[model samples]
Target: MPAATRERAIEAAVELLGAQGVRALSHARVDARAGLPPGSSSNWFRTRRALLGGIVDWIAEKERADFDPAAMPVITHLDELIEGLCAMVELQSGPYAARTRARYALFVELAGDAELGEPLRRQRREFERWTERIVTAVGITDPVPATRAVMALADGLLLHRLTVDPDLEVRPTIERAIRALARS
Candidate 1:
């Protein structure tokens, strides 16, 4: 199969997973959603596991494209880090909301299936490492712990905003949290 076709199928799977959960993901469903010929997705991903892995790959690629640290400016202050993080939050809540939902859905869906959780774990570690880099660049003395704390804060805020408070303004809140963390 062509790489573009495979990518399209993966994108469709992500959309389906987000809109209808894991149960909605299937080769045929992905083919239909992607507007490809019948069995096209199956030709690329012969099993459900393969399909899920493809989705994970797609998510990782999208994230890397969205936030390339090499392309980012140097962070000189806590507020700068806050601004970058706030932009990230905004991205998740805006155009990438569906993908974010799909990711969390996969997390829940794979929670009991250790074999299928590898891709998610890899993606998460990538995120954590990137966060650590940012935290370190902000002059945090203990970046490892600070990175974990920042991740927890961001995750909690994202969950709250997505589930309980859709209108939550997170910039100020995240800025304050980062400032406190930087000082600690």
Candidate 2:
């Protein structure tokens, strides 16, 4: 099969994982969901681990695709960073909800597999580095820990939005926390 076939499979796999959690994922299910010939996913991935790895890469790519490091300088004010982060939270919980759900599923599902988790770890480290750079540019003294804490806060809020209350008005909270982090 070609790259499109692989992409379709990954996309369909994310849809499946999002709609029904990990139990819904299978080669045949992915093929049917993608409208590809039977065995297409297995043909490309060859193993369950390989399939999960592909899924991680796809989700990570989708997550990072919209972010541009050059945009960091544009956030000359704390309000700008707050707005950007709030927008990100909105996107993750709204338009990209399914992919976000699938990404979370994979995070928990493969939490114990060090080898398989490397891709996830790599994605997270890159995100943190970028966040640290943005924080450093904003003159945050403790960019390292501040970046980690901010990321953790975002993740927690995303989880809460997805799980507890989908209607959470996150802007005020995000603004307060970001401003406090920026100050500290």
Candidate 3:
């Protein structure tokens, strides 16, 4: 199959997963969603697991597509961290909403399938490690736990925006969390 078709299928799968849920994902569904003929997705992925794995890989690539590894940004101060995290929350819940939602859907649906979900798990760990560097530099007392707390809070806020309140103001909430942490 052509790479464009393959990518289209993966993109469609992500949309299906995001718009509906995990149970909505299938080769045929992706094909239909992509406006490709029957068997188009199967021609590339061949299995639901393959498509899902492909989706994870695609998401990881898109997430870090323009990220520069050597140019690690410095979150030198609490206010800087607050602003940076708020921007991240906006990007994750705004332009990347569908993909982010698809990623979270996969995380929940495939939590028990370590074999199939390893890529997603690995991506998360890698994100945490990257987050650790920023938090550590910012002088968070225990960077590891702080990373977890920040990630969890951000994710919760994202979920709330995605699921319940599309107009939720995330910056204040993030600022509050960071301020409370700073006071500790």
**What tens digits encode model 2's per-residue C-alpha lDDT throughout 1-184?**
8888889999999999988898888999999999999999999999878899899988887767766566544665677778888988888888888898998898899999888777778888888888787777777778888888889888988989988888898899988998898777
In terms of lDDT, which candidate is stronger, 1 or 2?
2
Ranking by TM-score: 3, 2, 1
Once fitted onto the true fold, the runs of candidate 2 whose alpha carbons sit more than 4 angstroms away are 71-73
lDDT of each: 0.84, 0.85, 0.85
lDDT of 1 at 20: 89
- At residue 11, give the lDDT of candidate 2: 94
Model 2 TM-score on a 0 to 1 scale: 0.90
- TM-score winner, 2 or 3: 3
Clashing residue pairs in candidate 2 are none
Writing each residue's lDDT as its tens digit, candidate 1 over 99-171 gives 9888888889888877777777787898899889878877987999999988888778777766778678998
Q: Give the distance in Å from residue 118's predicted Cα in candidate 2 to where it truly belongs.
A: 0.9
RMSD list, candidates in order = 1.9, 1.8, 1.5
Task: Rank candidates by lDDT, best first.
Answer: 3, 2, 1
Which pairs of residues collide in model 1? Answer: none
Would you give me the overall lDDT of model 2? 0.85
**Number of clashes in every candidate structure?**
0, 0, 0
Compose the digit string of candidate 3's lDDT tens values, residues 1-184: 7899988999999999989989999898999999999999999887888888889888888876644445546668888888888888888888889998999998998899988788888877888888888877777787888899998998999999889998898888999988787667
